[model samples]
Target chain A: MRTYGNSASVVVLLAWLLLPFATARAESIVLASTTSLDNSGLLGRILPAFTAKTGIEVRVVAQGTGQALATAARGDADLVLVHDPEAEAAFMAAGHGKTRVEIAWNDFLFVGPQSDRTAIGGMTDAVAALRLVSEAGAIFVSRGDNSGTDALEKRLWRAAGIVPAGQPWYRDIGGGMGAALNMAAALDGVTLTDRGTWLSFANRRGLVELVHGDARLINRYRVIELDSVRHAGAKLGPAHVLAAWLAGAEGQAAIGAFVLGGEVLFHPGVREIPPGE
Target chain B: MEEFVPIVLRSLAVSLAATGFAIAIGLPLAAALALGRWPGRPIVVVMVNALLGLPPVVVGLVLYLLLSRQGALGVLGWLFTPGAMVLAQTVLATPIVAALAHRAIEGRWRRYGPTMQAAGASRWRALPHLVRMAARGVATAVLAGFGRTVSEVGAVLVVGGNIAGFTRTMTTTITLETSKGNLDLALGIGLVLIGISVAVSATVLVLAGERR
Candidate 1:
C-alpha cells in the first residue's frame, strides 16, 4: 500500500517540480519568415554559422509571407524575413518596419505532373503558361494563403486576363507553400513555387519543373526589422544586428553557397537592385 | 529515424509534465468539488465539464496572448519556448483531469460521506481518506489527461513556435512533415505516437485488471 500510493505521489511531485528545469535557457530573437524559406532548409544551413559568430540564437516562426508580416506588425516578432515585394512595400509604407534590405533571390518555377496535361514544358513566360493551363482545363493548385507565391500567382492571372476563382480546374489551398506543393503532387496538378522550395522538396511524386527562368518569375527575399519605436518592447538591437548580418557580405556568401541535391537554390543578392524601388 | 527520437521524447516529456501538474492541481480541486457545499459549486462543476470541451487552439490563442511580448506574463520571456508549450498543455489538460477526477471521486464521496459523518469525521478529514480509496479511478483520470495533452498539436505548435531542435515536438513535427509531403517520416512518427499511447493505455488497463 505504501509503495503504490507513496511512489505514485512522489513521482508526480518530482516530475511537476523538475520538468521546467529541463528547458534550456538561451538568449534568442524571433524571426518571422515564409515557409518556403524555412522549409527549404536554408536557414538550417546558414543560421548556425550566424549563431556561432554572434552567439545570438534565431528562433524562426515560418508562416505565409502575409502572416509573417502580420506577426511583425503585431510586434510579436523581432524581425521578418519574407518575399513578395508588394507586401514588403506595403509593410514599409504602413510604418511598421524600420528598414528593408535584399538578402537573396530565386525564381518561381512552374511544376506539374510529368504527364504534362497542360503541355507547359519549355515555356519561359509564366503568364502565357498560366493562360495555357487555364485554357486547357488542367488542374492547377494555388497557395491561396495570401503568401508571396500566391500574390505572384494572382498577378500572373491578372496579367493573363483570367479569373481562376470559381473554376473547377483551379484549387486555392489556404495553406503554406509546402502544403500546396504536396497537394499538387498528390492531385498531379500544376503549381507555381519558389525555386528554393522546389529544389529542396524531396517528395516530388512524379512532378517535374514545367516552366522557369522568366524575369517575371523572380522571387526575391528581403529581411526587415520591425520599427523599434512602434514596438517599444521588441528586441530591436538584436533584430537590427541580425538584419545587418543577413544583408552583409558574409550572409550573401552563405546564401550563395547553400546547395541542395547538387543544385544552387538561391542566388545571393549582392549586386542586383530591387525592381521599382 | 534518427531525427525523430528527440521530437518523440520531447512530446512525452512535455505531456507527462503537464499531466503531473494537472493531477496535482486537479485532484485537490476535484476533491473540493465533491465534498464541499459552496455557493457556486454547481457552476464550478458545470464550468469544469464545459472546459473539457474547450478547443485546444482557443486555449493556445489565449495563452499566446498572455505570454506574448505585450502579454501580461511576457516579462517572464517564456514565449516561443518549450516552457510555453508545457504551460499551454497544462492549461488544456487541467479541466479534463478535474472533470474526470470529479466523476471518479463523487461516487466514493457519496458512499463514504454518511459513514464518516456518523463517525464524527469532518468533510476535510474524510477527503484524504476518500481520495486514497479512489486512487485507481484517479489514475485513469491522469491517463486520460496524458492522452489528451500528448495527442494535441494546436496549442503546442502555437506556443512552442515549432523551432527546430528547440521547441519541435512529435505532433508538431507530424504536422510539418505531412504538409511538406514527407509522408513517410510523418507516418513513422504517427506510428510511434500511437504505439506509445497504446502502451500507456494497456499498462493502465493491466494495472486496473490486477487490482480487480
Candidate 2:
C-alpha cells in the first residue's frame, strides 16, 4: 500500500515537472493552418528549423482552411496558413486580413482504386473527368468538411453541372484529407485530394492517381496576417515576420526541399518558376 | 450503412478496451484510497475527483505530444492509430472510474473496516469482500467510464487522426460529418452512438436485475 502511494506520487511529480517544457514559451505566436498542410508533414519539416533560426516559436493549430481563416478572423491566431484562394480573397476583401502572399503551390489529384472503375484516367480536364465520373454513377467520396479541397470539389461538381448530393454513388465522409483518402482506399471510391496529403498518405490499399494536371486543380497556399489596426490585440509584428519569412528565400527553399516517399509534394510559388526552370 | 459497421465496431472496441483498463487500474487505486489510512488521503481524493473533469482535448494534447514523431515515446509510433485512440480513451476514462469506484467502495469500506479490524483482519484482507459487496457500484463506475469514452471525440481525434477503417469511431465521424454539413450521415451516426449507450445501460440493468 505504501509502495503504491509512493509510486503514484512519483508519477504525478514527474508529470508536473515535464509540463512546463512541453508547452511553448510566452514568446510564441499561434499560427492557424489547414490540416492538409499539417498532416502532409510540411509544417513539421519547416517549423522546427524556423523556430531554431529565428527564435520565433510558431504554435500551429491544424484545422480545416475555413476554420483556420475563421480563427484568424476571431483574432485567436496571429497568422493563417491556408489554401482556399476564394476564402482568402473574401477574407481580405472583408478587411480582416492585411495581405495574402503566395507561399507554395500543389495540385489536387483525382485518385482512386488501381482498377480505375470510372475509367477517368489520363484526363487533363478536371470538369470533364468529374462529368464522366458522375455520368457513370461511379463512387466518389468527398471530404465534405468545407475544406479547401472540399470547396474545390464542389466547384468541380458545379462546373460539371451535377448536384451529386443525393446520388447513391456520391458519398460524403466529412473528414480531413487523410480520412477521406483512407475511406477512398477502403471503399474503392474515387476522391479528390491535395497532392501534399496524397503524397504523405501511407495506407494506399491499392489506390492510385487517375487524373491530374488540370489548371483548375492547382492548389495555392498563402500566408495572411490579420489587419491588426482594425482588430486590436492582434499579434501583428510576429505575423508579418512569419509571413515575410514564408515568402522569402529560406522559406521557399524549405518548401522546395520537403519530400515524402521520395516525391516533392509542393512547388514554392510555382507560378514564379519559368517553363525551362 | 455497410460503411458504418466498422466505425461502430471500432468505437465499441476502443471504448470497451478503455473501460477494461480503467477498471483494472482504477479498482486498485480506488481500493487504496478508500481502505488505506493516510495523512494526504483527502488531497489525493480531491485530485482524483478533479481529474474526472479533465478536458478531453488536454488529454489528447498531452498524449499527442508524448506520441508524436518528436515525442519522447515516438519510437512506439502509435500516433494516428486505433491504438492511440484506445490509449487516449483510457486516459479519459481512468479518472472517472477511479473517482466513481472510490465513492462506491468507500461506503462499503466504512461499514466493513471496523468489523474486519475487530476480527484481527488486515486492511487488505477486507478489500476483496468489500469489492464484491460494492460490485454494483463498481459496475456503475465502469459504465460511467464507458459512457465518457464511447462518445468522446476531441482526444481521440487528436491522437487517432480519425482515419477510416483504422481510427474513425462514431463520435469522430459525427464531428467530421457535422463540420462537413453532412447532417444526414452525422445524424445517422449520432443515433447509433446514442443507441450504443442505451444498449449498454439496458444490459447493465438486466444483469443487475438478474443478480437481484
Assess each model's interface with DockQ, reporting 2 decimals per model: 0.41, 0.05
Question: What local lDDT does model 2 show for residue A212?
Answer: 96
Estimate TM-scores for all models: 0.91, 0.63
How good is the docking of model 1, as DockQ?
0.41
**Docking level for model 2:** incorrect
- Please write out the lDDT profile of model 2 over residues A148-266, one tens digit for every residue: 99999999999889999989999998777877877788789999988888776666777899999999999988787778675566667877787887888998999999987788888
Pull out the clashing pairs in model 2: A144-B180
Q: How many clashes in candidate 1?
A: 0
Tell me model 2's lDDT, rounded to 2 decimals: 0.79
In the range B1-212, model 1's lDDT, one tens digit per residue, is: 22777677778778887887898899889988888888999999999999988899998989888987778988887878778888998988899889888987898988888999999999898887777777778778888899999899999888888888767888998888887677898898899999999987776666655654
TM-score of 2: 0.63
Lowest summed lDDT across 10 adjacent residues in model 1 chain B is found at: B203-212
